[model samples]
Target: MTLEADLRGASAATVRGAIERGDPLPGTAGFAGLVDGALVRDVLGRELVYVDREAAGEGASAGARAEANGSASVWSFDPGGLADPELLPAGSVRPLRGDPAGEDRGEPGGRQVWTLPDPAPETDEGAAVAAVRAAVRESVDEVGSTGLAVAFSGGVDSTAV
Candidate 1:
């Protein structure tokens, strides 16, 4: 039995493209980030990501978001551990140079406004089920014997490792 990731499930390259495009939720789970760049959350906003408020500043430009060396000051998947972290918007490709609006959509000052993709069609029920299983197996294997917690909504793309 093999598990295929859901329609939204994406490989590393695919995820990178999606993040650049600001499409729908990434093919993987709920979150993805570029090292030393902007931190991106899933379109569905299923996952929670935090960034340090002080470091991010108010309306920091893309170059200002993270240091030149790509240091993410205080971003974390854990909500409680963040020190004065703010929740990034869902489907937002942030830290742009200035306002994403009223300018070219592509890297205006090193930032892009997130554009949501079309909704996925619900087909391939059998394939989706198989993929679900595969994702679970892979996730468990990656986690090894460590205790893991998964929150699934009976739909694909939610069981993020």
Candidate 2:
């Protein structure tokens, strides 16, 4: 079963279309800042669970394992709310592959190849600043809210916002 939760803005529309068409997971670029949370099952039952990187620890239990990818960790799903579940080693378990409904795409999880944006910046500070400014402007325009709030930590990134 496909499940999406608290999707907002452009993604809410685009993903809704994909879901309606029974399409595999759609491109996620449109969801950059608007996805409050989302969980969707690919045709093979591989669930893509989105959680805040900051409070991710709160979702873990003794039986859950955390797979580190770069600076982020993907926590395994706990079958029950019990304090202790069978914790597999990090990276030991892979997402289940294949579609039970007989729609196999010859790929793991029957997932679609979604295009992603190239987030790399050119080697120019001025260009980087301009790009950031334009992105911020676009976000503000999309928000269309009279009130604005920033999750500030008084860091350089926060100050830039």
RMSD of each: 12.5, 12.3
> Tens digit of lDDT per residue, candidate 2, span 60-147?
2211223433233322343232222333221111222222332232332223323234566689989989988999889877985567
The Cα error of candidate 2 at residue 19, in Å, is 8.5
Per-residue lDDT of 43 in model 2: 35
Judging by TM-score against the true structure, name the best candidate.
Answer: 1
Q: State the lDDT of candidate 1 residue by residue for 1-161, as single tens digits.
A: 11122112334466567756656744566654432244555676776666666555545433323334555554545545544667767665543332343235334223434556566865999988998899988877787555756577876667552
Models 1 onward score TM values of 0.42, 0.32
TM-score of 1: 0.42
Q: Give the per-residue Cα lDDT of candidate 1 at 127.
A: 85
* Model 2 bad stretches (over 4 Å): 1-100, 107-112, 145-161
Give the clashing residue pairs of candidate 2, or none: none
lDDT top scorer: 1
